[model samples]
Target chain A: MTPIALADYDVVYRRPDALTDVQTHYCPGCTHGLIHRLIGEVIDELGIRENTICVAPVGCAVFAYNYFNVDGCEAPHGRAPAMATGIKRVIPDRVVFTYQGDGDLAAIGTNEIIHAAGRGEDLTVIFVNNANYGMTGGQMAPTTLAGQVTTSSPYGRDVDLVGMPMRVAELISTIPGASYVVRRSVHNVANINKTKAAIKTAFQVQMAGLGLSMVEVLSSCPTNWHMSADGALKWIEDAMIPVYPLGDYRVADAVEPLTKRRRPDRSQNGSLATIPEE
Target chain B: MAKELWKGNEAIAEAALRAGVEAYFGYPITPQTELLEYMAREIPKYPGRVFLQAESELAAVNMVYGAACAGVRVLSSSSSPGISLMTEGLSYIAGTEVPAVLVDIMRGGPGLGNIMPSQGDYFQMTKALGHGDFHPIVLAPSTVQEAVDLTYGAFELAETYRTVVVILADGAIGQMMEPVVMPPARPVMTEQERADWALRGAKDRERRILTSLHLSAEGLERMNQGLQNKLARIQQKELRWQETMTDDADLLLVAFGTAGRVCTSVVSAARRAGLKVGLLRPISLWPFPEQRLVELAERVQQILVVEMNAGQMVLDVKAAVAGRAPVHFYGRMGGVVPLPDEISAQIDKLVSEPAGGTGFKTGSNNGYGQPKAMPAANGVRA
Candidate 1:
């Protein structure tokens, strides 16, 4: 028998309070909405909503300042890390992070991100990789997959012409300044859970003053991919995952033990878990 | 509070430190590297102060944008080319109304010209500093002590107006040494106050987003109009200049920065020759001391505009004179510092023919190398 009452069951999920009630402008099936929710959820769990500053990059997420209910400023395309560095260095106690997309982080901003990472700036970086430029009408991005077709790569991405897709996580992990670096996907429920855990670890890395930390989440852009929402999710699992494998490429030894157990108060049951000190 | 002999660059750096600057980020460029180096040496002395030699001018300015937006007193210094690289960031800072200080120890150039001194950046600093309809408070100091004072005052002005304040110094000033009585350090914005103005976590207040990008035409118009009003207020309240011997003079020498200092000697020499010559040194170049210049133009028989470049500020002087007094220009171009004797000669010539026409006149050794024939346009001479 079908239940007539919608409020018959306990509340299982809802939007994070850290996120504004205003609807975001993200296109349908764009995983940016999911990524924003995870970030908001993490900020809510840490109770750092009031003390958080998000540097919104210039891309599809350029208006991220409006999306998050935290103090933020827009950075010139690819300069979010530099701005975050300024904010954190000026006010060290405040939590600061940069939200950037594939084109924003890997293209024009390559020099800035690399230098920011090399300096071991105490900030978090949330990078979204969708293989193509979602903004400016699907141009070939630095992270565009080999043989992937886009407006700039009308004849499919030519490895010989444009080189292989940049493995940002792998490149960043090589830097000694990067204390924690991980790549995760949000294509499925299981992977989405891992991605949230990685995001939490990135924040913890900053909390411990363990230097720069980054989480690269493989996202799907159904509109830019010219595929249905379901097909784009399938492509992320089949094509994107194989190219950018999911793993923790660099977790400094000091960070290893910290990630083992969760903070008790940060439970998902709407109750404070026993936060035991390690 | 004791007097100490300091180079202009070093004086500016010490002044910024005393002004309670929380952070200093810059990239090394000629004539201004000492300023950066001084910060590197001194920042370690203060607890919680930050100093960084950025990877590039682009990065340095963006970092400044961040620090400024966060409601802290911050600064950066560079030469002509480096400041050019920073113009884009400066535009963003202006649009967002972020308070910050930028120092330019000018050398020659449209490109990587030279390490020698030149006032060629006058138009660049006063008129077209950055894109969009924004104007920064441009201060030009002649001596090391004045450099220290202007640099110290610039921080306060930036905070007061919530806008960028530029200390436009020449390479000569940056390299020269003079005694300066440094200002005592005053209290700066507290962390809480800074966070209140900055995007320092929206923990206690509604989220504040510092941005220059306004999509709505009406919204952008309001922001731009607000900036214009601020600039108008700054122009009215902050016009600074020094007049020496202009009371009964038939000739007035108008100059600023190092060139203005040189004109002091020229004025004295012209007076020794029994000519009533005076000097008007503008301490604030952007405000241009136009109102005072207009008043002085009525009394003086002729005005001699002297500089180290191909006549930039003279245009402003001419505009201020507005045909009441004929304005003649004598300048050395491309980093060549004009000699007092040559400036005196120009003063003598302009005074000798008080009713003469107005045009540019090149001094010997046009800040470049050897002198060339001048473009003889309407009494213009080399």
Candidate 2:
């Protein structure tokens, strides 16, 4: 019953030092917590946790600042990319990233993200696509899957009226300024491990002073999706992958060397993860 | 420093550099494009400086908000429509209590009025710059030298109050060339200095969070109360004004920016014509020179408020005068500039009238509006 009463017990795992001890307000089965952990781990691995600035967007992850033990700025809806650009430009020595969700990125902030990637701002973007506006109570998002049911799309999203969902990774990859653009999911352990690698690679590209690097993670929102925790994870693999198509949308010439091979002595967590060749 | 003929917009850009502006973010807008151009060309010359031409006013202002949150000296310049798009970011910056300098080189408009200089943004600048219970420190410069001077001092004021400082100039001041003795460059904010409130990183310290959002009522109200207290301190200590012939005067003319520039001549011509007239030009428009105006209102006969817009600042003048003196408004709408003679005629009417008459509202104000069309200018149509 007293699990940790024995101080002599071995500590198998610990929260990444980049993350604060505060409990997240994320709902059960919400993968924002998972994404935050992956980012924290990446920062902890890169040893840039102290020199990293996080830009928080207006969404479920608006308080991402509270969970991250780094300097942070809470940007307006859809404005995180611009804020990241601002931070990176002013403090180029510091690592900067933006944590944005579907409504914050695909819908309201399309302009800022597009231009940020277009200009090749030396910043990292962790965009979480959950197919709905999670914080705003499951409204139809720009990334809302076609024919998906939601509050705003009560009769399901009609492609004729609202148009097709935006594939942000593919769109951003077309910009010459974007050095690394990819989409990954957290539906299962394999994909979760891959998503963590992609997140780490993004920070690596930024650290290398390459260009705008974005890792769009397909996250699960069980509460908003009106599904059980297990069902939301399964839905990403069954329904989300077909539309999103997890793949490397863009890898600039300079980034290939870093991506193609795993550095010899990496993975302090003891999991040698690899990007899905697909 | 030797005086050199510098264009207003360019003077502002150089002044920003002298103030050691760390970043410049803006979109190209008429009468203020030179400022952005100058930055684009020169920001790179400095070892580590930033110059970004944002996609739109909305994007530009947000970039400004981002840079401001970093606790650096940043600048943005735009005319009316562009400034309108910036309202959202300005509000967030105000709530966040960050320092930023905005130079609003006013052209004309409630709409696409003209490229002609007009003080139409008086209400927009001094009153509702952005929504919320907040106010920006507004400095309206009357000439190019003054514009440079204000641009030099604005950053300090903004950082001092941790608020936005808007250097309000019009197209005339922005476009015209004037002799300016530029101030030497002040040292840029050091990293140690910025660590006080900037969001650079959490190195060797607790993380810093700069956010305006407070979901709970108590939290937001406390922030608002703090903002109000800061504004009160600004209003008390930062009221600036320039008065001439007010030592013994019957009629005092109230105006700012270009209106104030022209009224100086109007007052001189009126005085030459045997009238005891003075000009009370307000330099700091937000703190508003209200107390000074109220004090002067006690001695003056009828306070005449002159502007290039349709009676905006007169409202504040009236509120401050509070019937201590009767306030009459003389303004030219549709981006029309009120000539000295036109203002003098209005003053003549006010002086000749025995007691009470809405002296300048008799449709004759449109006289200036009729001839507003020029080859390069907009607004007047055939």
Candidate 3:
């Protein structure tokens, strides 16, 4: 029998089932969904769906737990890093990560993030940098550009008072324990692919037990940026990328396989058992 | 039988070890410093137990916070000023209902109060020590034996109520030495027992979160109400006190912790002097022995309250008595502990007076009624 030739094959390019069907709380043209998709694809590909633990930050993505199908915890404002530390320490075998925005990671939580990286904790962090605080209606952020205007800075950010925008990828790259640090963007198809690669690499570094890894994604917030979705994409490409160049800030040439080496089992060694009462 | 002569602080450490404590995180401070020192030496000797000498009181408490969030048995101990520094962490633990134990070996307070024995932290322990509407289960131990027994009790109550349990003692009790029969060893939890909610290496389960903050007003109110309900259950089941000869006494000595020990001697002396005196010793300071005091108030004409501070527990005693009988108070401040003879003298004065007349009573014909008793000769026998 001759095989029948079909002219068309049906396929849908919609949201993943792991993602909620409800409308997003994010502004139109915001790159949060694109980043979410990249993370979801990686989670699905790595077969870590059941064991992965995510700490949601207190920002635009505070309700991220509702959208992600994996286990998630909502942390206090600027405390996602510390919360992630707690989760990772107690469950060292679990693949734990924190998703944070510029305001949540760079300002109030700077100490927590710095300490976690310094300690070389085995965890991953996904930092979304939109140059402003989105959920609080576009206030100034630690990453807001020199001349950008926000609700708190009506005359635009003054370099003298607030200082220049921080380059977090570059900053974290200097940390000795940071196994992998990269900066990526989500403006277009080409950049989206690069961001996905960066996220995958960061997770792979964590799985390898190299230590702390982070991916900083430059995203767009069109409503807060006072632009249309297309305009916001254009603005991110034209204005944001120049100041925050995207690339791997620090990458290890080769990492030891995490599975090859077995961690000392404190339990098997009779370390965690109760001692006789004195 | 595990019998040993132990310092009050060391006995507490031994009790915690026997109770299957998983970790001990602490900073050194006077009086209670032995507790941490002993833990630092002993905990490491036990294969599974961890003992950390933290960078500061802040760090010690946070380390405890970390261990507690992981749903393990952890403890921290300090003196008065150190406990003040721990209030922030304690508040978080209480607000989040993390099960843990804190031992406060009380010293003088209000500022850099002396490191000698004083009950100045009575209010801080029984009342909310931190900034919020939260209360910890406060246990006051009068003797070294009680120190061991109550510490064990604190851990059990903490897990049962899912709240912070405080063993509130003074320098005298914390530093004093006595014989103790240690408790039997507790069995470690099986993997299945802790696998449900513990954060241990998240395997094939949802992430667990431990936090105290709730953004919404209604959410916070609900949390507060839930905590109150738990506390009510504790009150019904955990209220503890000791009564001696209150059945047919004209005078009752109400005290707690080290003060109760001193009051015992005073009661004996008052009895010998032909004054019917008994003692009401409170073990639990939070669910306080209020009902017991009220019941005693009906039989006794006067209740003499002794403490090592400036009238903190006296307020609770007054509230318990409710004016049915006079509540007389004798206290010393700045780490000066009143002796048994001084307390006995105070008892004599109260018993000789009319019913419903306190030392602090105003406009009394007796010159130096309250203020006169203040600078009494140090009545400790040479």
Q: Output the number of the TM-score-best candidate.
A: 2
| DockQ of each two-chain model | 0.79, 0.76, 0.18
Backbone-clash count (model 2)? 0
Q: Give the whole-model CA lDDT for all candidates, comma-separated.
A: 0.86, 0.87, 0.78
Candidate 1, residue A222: CA error in Å?
A: 2.2
CA deviation > 4 Å runs, candidate 1: A1-9, A262-278, B192-195, B353-382
Sort the predicted structures by lDDT, highest score first.
Answer: 2, 1, 3
**How much is the lDDT of residue B39 in candidate 1?**
96
User: Residues B125-214, candidate 1, lDDT per residue (tens digit)?
Assistant: 888878999888999999999999999989889988988899999999999999899999876667655635677777656889899989
Name the 10 consecutive residues with the lowest summed lDDT in model 1 chain A. Answer: A266-275
lDDT of 2: 0.87
lDDT of 2 at A224: 91
TM-score to true structure, per model: 0.92, 0.94, 0.79
Q: What is the lDDT of residue B314 in candidate 3?
A: 83
Docking class of 2: medium
Model 2 CA deviation exceeding 4 Å by range = A1-10, A263-267, A270-278, B362-382
lDDT of 3 by residue, A1-278 (tens): 97656546333344553455677677678889878888876676566767777777889998776666666656656666665665565456778888999999998778667767887778899999999999899999999998899998889999999899999999998998887888999888778766776777678788878889999999999988899998998988999999999987877655433212322223422111112232
Model 3, which residues run further than 4 Å from truth? A1-37, A57-61, A65-67, A70-80, A101-105, A129-175, A219-278, B24-69, B78-96, B111-118, B129-132, B199-223, B272-274, B352-382
